[model samples]
Target chain A: MLQVIRNSLYFGGVAALSDVSFSVERGEIFALIGPNGAGKTSMLNCISGLYHLSAGRIVFDGKDITRLPAYKRAELGIARAFQNIELFKHMTVLENLMLGRHVRMKSGVLAGGIYWGKAQKEEVEHRYAVEEIIDFLEIEHVRNMPVGTLAYGLQKRVEVGRALALEPKLLLLDEPMAGMNSEEKEDMARFILDIHEERETTIVLIEHDMGVVMELSQHVAVLDFGMLIGFGTPEEIQANPKVIQAYLGEESLLEVQG
Target chain B: MTAVQSPFAIGCGDFRVNYTQDMAIYKNVRVRRRVIFLVILFFLFPILAPEYYVSLATMAGIASIGAIGLNILTGFTGQISLGVGAFLGVGGYASALLTTRLGIPFWFALPLSGIFTAGIGALFGIPSLRLKGLYLAMATLAAQVIIYFLFNHWDALTGGTGGLVVQRPSLAGFSLDSEMSYYYLMLVILILTALFTLNLFRSRVGRALVAVRDRDLAAEVMGIDLFKYKIIAFAVSSFFIGVSGSLMGHYTLVITPENYGTQISIEYLAMILIGGLGSVMGSIYGAAFITLLPVVLRELMTAVREVFPNLESIFIGIKEIIFGGIIIIFLIYESEGLAKMWRNLKDYIKLWPFSY
Candidate 1:
């Protein structure tokens, strides 16, 4: 469904993603894992059209969307959740998801102004779609609640729910399990797996948690100092020399502290 | 935390329920009936009330319509505009000029002037697509000053600082030259405007405006065109304010440049602030309160001055002091505004029998 072709580009006299490339198959859970400043998020941003590729092309679903705007990409069934959960805080959860259904909505400003006829019919249909996602996410009780009042973990889930409301062909989850407890991590992993297996949604996730990635992702891409060090299955990723070397220092430190 | 309940609680208890219930213009059956009753009252009051009271009510009705427009922009869209008077001025001048010079019928001039002013407001709001908050407010403020300047200096178009005399609007050969007829017409327009605005909240454009207001970046990511919605907000608001302006112009039989200036914009803001920001009924409550304040104060001032000679200036000073004080007190105590306070009081009475 997607691929990233990297090149030796200078980021303020430093190389960010150095001539690296990888392809993700449709309906697969692709995990991007790396240390801090590894440019994992940068690569995701390029894929999502938040930032333009400096030296390569981004072809998605047999179309070149390299120069498209973020919203345009979203219109083409590309949905992304931010690393720091970006929900419309003052708006109700329903309203937030309703906004997610923005691309699919067929009504124009003129139709909305009349508030009867076609607009009302379209609104009722959209409401049904949003309610289905709410039921799927098990957020029925807090459906009308403002996302701001929810706990951090629930907020992250709501963000995913919003992206799901888009019913995208490709979903980009940026650090969905960041700053979560073990219980929350399990919940998030289960949800991500459900998105991949049940909905047949192509998912590209940036995750720092090794266990979650190994358990949930079928393919893994490792980044180190803005370079693609490894790309393969979780088993292959664990056995990769560069991957082992990357985690060795942290592992030894924990051992020494113990 | 005391876990205090708001006196203004009307819908379901929590924010979630409150939000869902508020999505409806008339939340419950009772509210719907009340709205219908008010619509009837709007058309009836002019015929039923005395001439002076009818005039006052008409002015309130007109101002309320304008305030509702301002509320949509400032309260819902989170774009602070200090140029309601300027937009109104555009409408007033457009209607006055069209009716007097072009010989267009009053009925045609009213809506045409509104559309004309909306165009002008959209022009001013273009910078709004890129600017926000204090910057946007300043841009609108600059627009207000520029409009006022043009109104004063453009003698050819606006008849100079001497102002333009407006011919009363007539519909279907029936003259609205009298106060009663003007009042009735204004009342009908006001009710229609309010109803239109009420329905707007449930629509996509309205929802988009709210989304942009809450989190613009998120909305942009969600595929909402921020520039389009923001400008639409200004345009719709201008249309409503313009209609109020056109009505006022015809009713007064005079279109003075000074009448539509920064002071009136401030007065509208004060009404919204004192009444409640973002609440629909707040606009009406606030507009009525502010419109009637000077009159109420004048009565008190006259009585006080007569009882104690040489106290007129002091009473006037006290008016300004109290005016500022009220705004401050409301901001500090009930930041949600008087409408919230009103709602809370009603809720407290409704729930009084139950123990905490």
Candidate 2:
């Protein structure tokens, strides 16, 4: 359950997002689809609290989170995976995921220094949870490996696995399958389906793949030049002329549906 | 996670059978035994060696503490601080003032001095929230000048350029008047410092610090508050530096404004760089190497002077020259520092003559 109302963002004189609003129901996968530079990633960034909306309000599960800091938003069960793969590059996948559970861990510098007591117990508990995520993402073998040297698709999966480690109420994924091959895409789609079906997480996804978007998402919102042009179910979005015109340039989305 | 070799692996690996085993700091009994052996060897060295060498060991041990503190901030957290020398001075002065002026015991004064320096370090670290890289360096450089100015001009507190004097600390009612006893105290503290920091980097706090270093944005998304952690890093780092400074002052029975200048900060930086950034063991090796360089060169000069009297003047300043040259060579040859070299040595020995 998340709501965005009258969302607008600007950089100098240019509008990155303008008067865009949308709402997602609980336990549903929501899709934000648009052509290049159509503000989908910016919208995700805004809702995730990485970028503050210039004039808007974001309500997450009945809490006004528009002005909440990014870290605070994370504490409030919001997690995000970046399009550019913003994982901690030099740290191991295990450590990266452990960082996802940071808001939950209470150990401080002194406790961490003398780490055989409370800090060790907390670390082991979190490590077990992280290992479960590693199992879910099928990356158990690479748990100790630094993500910097990981392959692109694997790195992308680690990104999602990190977000999942938060046990988040709302998860934002930006272009998760952008550089993935068809088989990797299929695998990622399966993982997303499993997460939705099993965990019942509310996901907001930014994607360029028409088939994946239409098949996986229950609701789709199309943006064109910073404005919301269409908001409906998958079948309804495929038939909308404005979405057909602005998203995938008329023939491409129509061809996917056909 | 990739095609490259995982650096976290122990030699030949495959030992872990469970999650608890996997999370262990010492991967095997052999590694644990080896560490104990090395620590025992350190304790035995003073008994076997001369008092001169023992004094040198004390200095190296103190330097090790300061260098480790710098590594936590610069190496692990990726926050460059040019204010280490000033922070060390803060500790020395704070402890000296605490013990002499307030008549507090040495045990309590040491940690109190650390807290004092941490306060100052956090104050200087405030600019780091908005600055990075060279800009942050400049801000810390300003801290160096400002703290140094206080040390020189704050006559009532710091005694200005005349500095302060301290008595050797007594532990559990045992006065550490002898060089050997003091060396033992320094040794024990150094071991604790090493163990504490080694424990630190293996846990969640260390992970958060490294996350902030690698990508602050991603860390923020993961709920690691950047400002809070950065300030914590500053405070934690300075705490150790302050303790080190206090130890140095007590050992020498004197604390002066001249002791901690910009050159001292540069040397500490060199310690982390040469030892290996982000490594507790590397800090020790680097500090020992840097500390012993001048003394070793001086001894060699005396021995060579006996054989060839004409060669004496040519090597007059060779200690400084060799110090700069070794750091440069280390930078080019092994940027990861001596810790990496030590790891390579272990790997090589494990593989043996096969050389894979």
Best by TM-score: 2
Residues B1-356, model 1: lDDT tens digits:
78777987655633325333545666676667887897787677777888888888888888998898899899888999999998889999999999999989888999999899889988999999888999998999999999999999999999988889987766778877788887778777876776677667667778788888887877777777788889899999998889889888888888989888998888888888988877778988888888888778888778887678778777777886777788889889988797999988888877787825
DockQ for each numbered candidate: 0.47, 0.74
* Pairs of residues clashing in candidate 1: A6-A19, A6-A20, A7-A19, A144-B16, B7-B344, B8-B343, B8-B344
Interface RMSD of each: 2.8, 1.0
Model 1, chain B only, scores a TM-score of 0.90
Instruction: List where candidate 2 sits over 4 angstroms from the true fold.
Output: A248-258, B1-14, B307-311
Q: Mind giving the per-residue lDDT tens digits that candidate 2 earns over B175-196? A: 9988899888889989988888
Candidate 2: tens digits of C-alpha lDDT, residues A47-68: 8888998998999999999999
Clashing pairs in 2: none
Per-residue lDDT, model 1, residue B37, is 91
TM-score of each: 0.90, 0.95
